[model samples]
Target: MDRIANIHTLTKRLIVMTAISLLVFSVIFGISYFFNGRLMMTWLGFVCGIIGGFVSIQQRIKNVSDEELTLLTNSWFQILLVPIFGGVFSLVLYCIFLAGIISGNMFPNFYIPKPSGSVPDANFMIELFTKTYPLTGQDFAKFLFWSFVAGFSERFVPQIVNNVADKSSEKVNPSDR
Candidate 1:
């Protein structure tokens, strides 16, 4: 009985998180395409948002204590932060790409040419979102690799940072006299 209830709760959490993630991904992709006129950021945001939302939900399920289960049951909204953070990270990477900080060695032909002197309007942005870019086999492979990195990095980097912070804090505070 208890096991069935736990499973039921997990199922609900997963459904809520996935729905919220889809909404977030769509909105972020639309906004990113509007501002950047690029599909890369939109793709990255969608991938990262979905992956981050699921990963965070999994973490919550694993870490939930009996006392915390009631709190977690009603906290489906908290999972939205994971995707938002991931999308922001993707945007930062897109900015770095625009700034020429990263080269397209693996994807030399991945560039999508933008129209000159024509500012993108809502229709243009919508069209851009609906349109698909042509990618060679190699370019597609590189994109998949980068997308996975972007999706995973959102969760991975924070764990690395927290681990480093914990180590440094322990060294500074020396628990044992």
Candidate 2:
């Protein structure tokens, strides 16, 4: 009876936490959209991450074995970390995709500004960042999909990161090879 009650409390906490998180993200994303179109991709990715977190938590509590649940020492703080990790992982994966290391299809497409010799001004840096940051419409959905996947699969991004690290190691130390 105690175990069941504890489980209900945890589930309710997660639901409330996730709802608050979604509202916050949406508000921020809405404000950011007007200032910089490029931020939309990043914003959407984080939202997807939060959703993934919520889904992951719901799924976890549903099937958590009695023995597994019993042996674990846990708290609301611990459970809340899943969505937090989800959002962070989504951002990291976005960077990896932006770097074009994953796949040609996964790379974010963007508008290429024509080279112009313009005098520096207050707007120059802002304009440059705005141009460089946003993804073109063509690949927007693709990136969004991958970002959600990254948040959902806890193992996937870590595996890719490790693989990237391994590949990078060779470039740093030729003597080892």
Candidate 3:
């Protein structure tokens, strides 16, 4: 009976901590967004961070088995499918059916001018990252900063909250009894 009660108490505490963490996380991300440029990809990173944190909390409480973690990690392969499909799209564009739509709009411009019928320009490879749109220099920096903060908060906050809860319960429950 005591063990069950403790389990229930822990669950409740985790729930409350998760909610409060989410609120704080939102406030921090919102402040960043307010101060930064209004780019859609940067905004998406914040949303993804909160969602991933929520998922991690749920999985932690459920005491997900190793098999479950493997499955969850494997699910990231779905993201790789985008690049696979993109390559096919690029092929179609090269075939002239898409007429440079995929290459021009989606990917970095890789126009490497040949040096008098020699190899393509050496700077072409370097320019790929230096010239990406939508995720230009500033947006990439802000995205990295916010992602670091979110990852740190998600990994550490719950442990800290749970430790505090455990200590408080031990001190108060013993006194009350």
Q: Clashes in each model (backbone N, CA, C under 3 Å)?
A: 0, 1, 0
Q: Rank the candidates by lDDT, best first.
A: 2, 1, 3
lDDT of 1 at 64: 71
lDDT of all the models against the reference? 0.56, 0.71, 0.41
- Where does candidate 2 stray beyond 4 Å? 34-39, 65-74, 106-138
TM per candidate comes to 0.50, 0.74, 0.29
lDDT of 1 by residue, 24-112 (tens): 66777788679876554456545654565466556556567765555545565654555556655554444333344456676313444
Tens-place lDDT per residue, model 3, 1-177, is: 343443454445446644765586577667755765333332334444444444344446347455544443345343223223323322222222112322333232222223443554656533432232233555444433333334334433234346656877898898765
lDDT of candidate 1 vs native?
0.56
lDDT at 33, model 3? 54
Residue pairs with backbone atoms closer than 3 Å in model 3 (clashes):
none
Q: Report the lDDT tens digits of candidate 2 across residue range 66-113.
A: 665543225666665777788788988877766667867655665434
By TM-score, the better pick of 2 and 3 is 2
Flag regions of model 3 displaced more than 4 Å: 39-177
- Give the CA lDDT, 0 to 100, for residue 138 in model 3: 53
Task: Quickly count the clashes in candidate 3.
Answer: 0
Q: Which of candidates 2 and 3 is the stronger one according to lDDT?
A: 2
